[model samples]
Target: MIHSHVPVSDLREHIGRTVSVRGWVHTLRLQRAMQFVVVRDGTGLVQVTNRRDGGPLEALIEALTPESAVRITGRVVDAAQVRLGGLELVPETVEVLNPAATPLPIDDRTGPEQRLDWRYLDVRRRPAARLLFAVQTTLEQGMREYAYAQGATEMHTPKLMGTASESGAEVFELGYFGRSAYLAQSPQFFKQMAVAAGIEKVFEIGPVFRAEPSFTSRHATEFTGVDVELAWIDGVEDVMAFEERMLAHAIAKVADLHGEAVAEHFGVRITVPTTPFPRITMAEAQEILRSAGWDPSGTKEDLDPEGERSVSAHMREATGHEFVFITHYPVGLRPFYHMRAADDPGLTLSFDLLWNGLEVTTGAQREHRYDVLLAQAAEKGLRPEPMQDYLNAFRHGCPPHGGLGMGLARVLMVLLGLGSIREATFLFRGPNRLTP
Candidate 1:
């Protein structure tokens, strides 16, 4: 019987011993008297050398193709001339499990769309792609650890809702038992419901759906959202403080774990951001952009992409920080649930966190008082009957709470200096592209 397969990365420990290596054939070099086969596994690659003797093994080696699944019984040896870690495997037998077809659909020269069409094959061939996911995993893990330490409970809210959770124009509605049901745009309402249910601190990392026809590099129809809610918050500042600390913790974890790999593969140096990230009010941001020669063609109260980039650039230059919170947005630009600022009823106690010139988070203190919520909804021209159930959460008794929804892919994109959200996501779902 063939021996159990050993990972290519573990070959160093088994030198001077017979072993079985299993992986896809990365490359094959055939000569008149010798053949060199480089096998690639998830961990690393190993080079195998075989001397030609007109044997059955020679035919199997000749028939092997790149990326073919195979198991090779071999003796591990330390060869000074070998390039791959100075180690080579001398094969005693070769077994081809599955041979890949010739002329792969994608290659190093393939464009983005074609590469995405064969995502699995493309990911297998790129080391940097693998490292991007590793950093993402560590980032999520660090965030979860910090949340748990802060007495936060993890939650999974329903993706289907009877009413459009946010804007009806951006919701995906379908018939459910003859009644229309909508895909949840955010876990905003349910997270508040959890707060009213006495689960004061809660967090959810789940898929969010948006029916936006945006073709920008940062927009996706379906993406992962990192959400958090905390009750008994004094103001929006509490929410911002929690988010900044949590993010710093998670980023530090990524920097600690995969700093070298990220630097090597993506050429990015991960830095753990300092606490109390620079904060500038929305009015201040617009003024800063205007001073920098920003065009005022768009809305005067809100910062467009160019305005956001200008503000981020200014903060980075002034404070040497990568993250800045733009706060106190006008009421017209915020949702009805966002609590209006007491000092200025025309503005909401809300903030947007911008990292590397991209807005990744929007958070605010929610108006928990039932009467104020209804009045705000009416002011926005929204009828209260369809949202009575949500209103009931606040009608009874709910603490003053606030939270933030963060775009997972956007964070990953900025962290690794990725050009687009598609590169950071595992299976990108966009306006025109859906399949793997």
Candidate 2:
């Protein structure tokens, strides 16, 4: 059965009809004869007015307070004076469902740490903060939409692993019976296993655990990883291009859906990046950074935070692009699984996609040959004896495969121009932060 009552966001649709709306009181104004109350459902806000000379709502209006939960039935009318939509609700009845407590724990000017302590209340007060998740939803949906259209199979790899997912370091070790188990650092090996299992293209969006103690804005103990694996790839360039177009499609969808609202709310300009995002080799990037007066004393194989920013700035200025892919990282910097270039064996066929001066993704063409994979593992000083199961996939027969792991929060942070990854995360899980 369809009900007559609707959300405040759709109140504009039932402008001339009498309807019921329910939400928390966003702001309440008291007058001698008439009172104005603005209420917010997660969708949007609507203004409700109660005439003190009312029929049955005067006392109820008098009892209302900020954040009061209420169900209000009223006639929707045009009020040019009202700022929101030039329309307001003239209340015929008001029911205070739950009177809010006197003092809210957090407010508009609250610090990020304190606001995190009371995230539920904090999110309720700021509609823009709510919109961040909305944008995130659209961004993820866009990726799925593109992936499904490309005939990719959606997958969920296990979060608990019998062995370390990435290199042995930065893994969360826990008890599994009398033995030990580690949290899956990334869906890296399993995603490749799926590719070897004859699933051509597979993608998963799930939690990834890292035991890093760094408390930087970008570092988190647990975070959502967007993983993608594909079989029959030409080289690392194929994987880089796949991610480039995927992210471009996602950013375009975000711009199409919530561009205007996000612009107004977050004061950010959304631009869908053009296809074939600027690409530069890691050596080229380092040289460009050096040319830009960036000193890289100890950082020879990989880019530091400042170097990444410098290279991104160079790309942005040189080509007027917001994204740049730094490819061909040294073999020492990348994992053992990354395929080494045939000509230059010292460098791996790997890439990191930088968005607006921050690294958001790392991808490479995985070595699919079983013998080479084992040799690479041995070269990296890793134990391949325990990884016989993973090796079996390649030993039997495996196609040339490649994949990338992207940080979901970091993507949203860069897209929305937010201060930090934590600001973009829903309930941030840092080294120290654990609760609501």
Candidate 3:
């Protein structure tokens, strides 16, 4: 009977016992008298040594190559001189389950596009790739834990919509049955509907689609979105406060769990940010950017990428914090659903959260009054016929509510200091590339 394979990480517990280790060859070192094969399972790596005499074991070791999946039956032993876990596996039998092909398509020097073409191989060869997903899993878990503790219900809204969800120009249209259907751009309307139905506090982590053909480092055709909505808030500040606390809690958990691994793998230090992250109005942010030698005269209503980085840097210097929320955007720049400031009708109670010089989140207090919502939609040249159901939610009776939509990949990218969203995502989808 064949024994179940043990993970390389647990080999220390079974010292001196004959066990079967199943994994891929990490490295193969052949000398005149001995052969050393380093095997790697996802848990860890173990060195398997065999004598290079004229025997079948040596012949099998000679035939093995890097990344070849194999089942190695060996006895675990302590080796004080060895660097990897202070242990080694003495091979008694070998089984080559699957041998890798000669001449791999990717390596350390391979370009980004080709490496993405062969992403599975690239991830197996690079430790950072595995670490990246592991961090993502932990990050999501931390956020979910915080949300659940806060009495928030997790919901999964439909992705297919009867009409274009938002920004009609960027909607991906498809044929449904006999008419046209659109991919839900954001759960904005449905989340609001949940609030109207008395779900009070809710959140969703799901895929968001964008039809824009942007090829920027931060842009992607499809990505994961972390969304949250709350009802009966006193003002937009309540939303901001909730977000800051949620993020702080999540970051602290990540730091506790994967901080050291992140530092070792990506050279990034995870700092748990203080609550009530620094807040600055949009006009004030522009002023700060101008003072920092960045001319933003060409863009008044919105901040460009350079302007975001400049303001973030300024805030970091002034507040000793990496996160800053630029708030009170001009009404024209935001969507019609955002609530208008009572003191200034031209500005909306909205904000964009910047982390480490990147725009990671956009949130606002939504206009829940039915009459005001209709007028705002009309002013923006939006016909009420297409999104009538969304408008009807406010007509009956809805409490004051607000929410935010955060880009998950963008957060991960900034967290790991990766060059692009492509590097952060498991399988990136863009305009130019689609297959594996």
Candidate 4:
């Protein structure tokens, strides 16, 4: 009987045992009398060696190519010659499950644009791609752990909606049963509905669609958003603290499990940020930027890409921190949903979390008063009649709450110093990219 086992790198006490492994050929090195074929099983790579027999082994070697799926029976051997785990598999039998076509469209040495065009082939060689996904899994698990501990309920909101949550940004409009429907830009309204429904703390991890047309490396048409809203919060600080702990836990977990791989592949160490990530008001960040010879063009509300880069560099140099919270945005710049500060009333209680010169999250205290919310919506030139359902939540005893929406791909991109957000996402959908 063929004993089923994973690759040698993932094998622990099962070494030196005969096992049946199935995977695709990653690399093939042939010598005069013997052949070394490296097979990848998604978990890891295992080196398999074959004797110079002019039978199945020879035929397999002759027909082998990258991405050819195969099943083999071999005895795991402890050998120092192999690069992975100091163990190799000596294959006694071989079966070609599927043969690959020659001349791949893209390879390991392909350029970024070409690789993106053929992402499947690119992902096959990119160790960083695998590491990014592993980190994402760890981060999501960490979020769930922290939320569960904090009494937050997990909710899956509808992706299709009748109207936009925030009246500002562009949305992808589609005909849903012959009515004007849009892909949900966020779980904002639904989460607030949960608060009105009396489910206090809530969180959702899901896809958000945007029709943004910029070709910036940080922006994407569709991306995963990590969001959480807490009911009965005093202010935005409570939500900020929750986010900080969540991030710290996720970073620590990822570093512990895949730190070495991250370093080797991405050339950066994952640092679990300390509590209370440097909070600087938007005005202060702008002043800091000016001190660093970056004139933000007198825009106190938002940071242009160059301004973001300069401020991030300054923060890293001065405080040795990659994450920074820029808070108290000008009320004019924020959406109608943002709760204005009680003391100032000119600035909203909103914050953007910047990691390595890129914005990964936008969070704020939401306006919970019915009249105030409606006034803000009208002031922002939005029709309050269309938002009657949403406004009703505030009227029916909605708690004082705040939340943040974080872009998962943007976080991964900045953390790993990837050139584009697309590099960090699997099956990326953008304004230009639609299919495989």
Q: What is the C-alpha lDDT of each candidate?
A: 0.92, 0.88, 0.91, 0.85
Q: Pick the candidate with the highest lDDT.
A: 1
TM-score of each: 0.98, 0.95, 0.97, 0.94
Better of 1 and 3 by TM-score: 1
Model 2, 1-436: lDDT tens digits are: 2237788878878878898898999988898887889988888888887777745577788778899898888889988999987889988777789999987777778899998898888877888889999999999999998888888999998998887754778999999999989998898889988998999999999999999998887889999999999899888778888888888888899999999999999999998989899999998997897777877786565788878888888899999999999999999899898999999999999899998888999999999999998899999888887787788889878999899999999999888888887788878887898987
Task: After superposing candidate 2 on the true structure, give the runs of residues whose Cα lies further than 4 Å from its correct spot.
Answer: 1-3, 13-16, 53-56
- Give one digit per residue, the lDDT tens place, for model 1 in 1-436: 6576788888889988889988888888999999999998888889999999999999999999888999899899999898899999999989899999987788789999889999998888888998888889999999999899999999999999998865577888899999999989999999999999999899999999999999999999999999999999988899999999999999999999999989999899998999999999998988898788876775566887878888998999999999999999999999999999887999999999999899999999999999999999999999998888889999778999999999999999999999999999988999898897
What value of lDDT does candidate 3 attain over all alpha carbons? 0.91
Worst lDDT 10-window in candidate 3: 292-301
lDDT of 1 at 293: 83
For model 3, the stretches where C-alpha displacement exceeds 4 angstroms are 1-4
Clashing pairs in 1: none
Q: Better model by TM-score, 1 or 4? A: 1
Q: For all candidates, what are the clash counts?
A: 0, 0, 0, 0
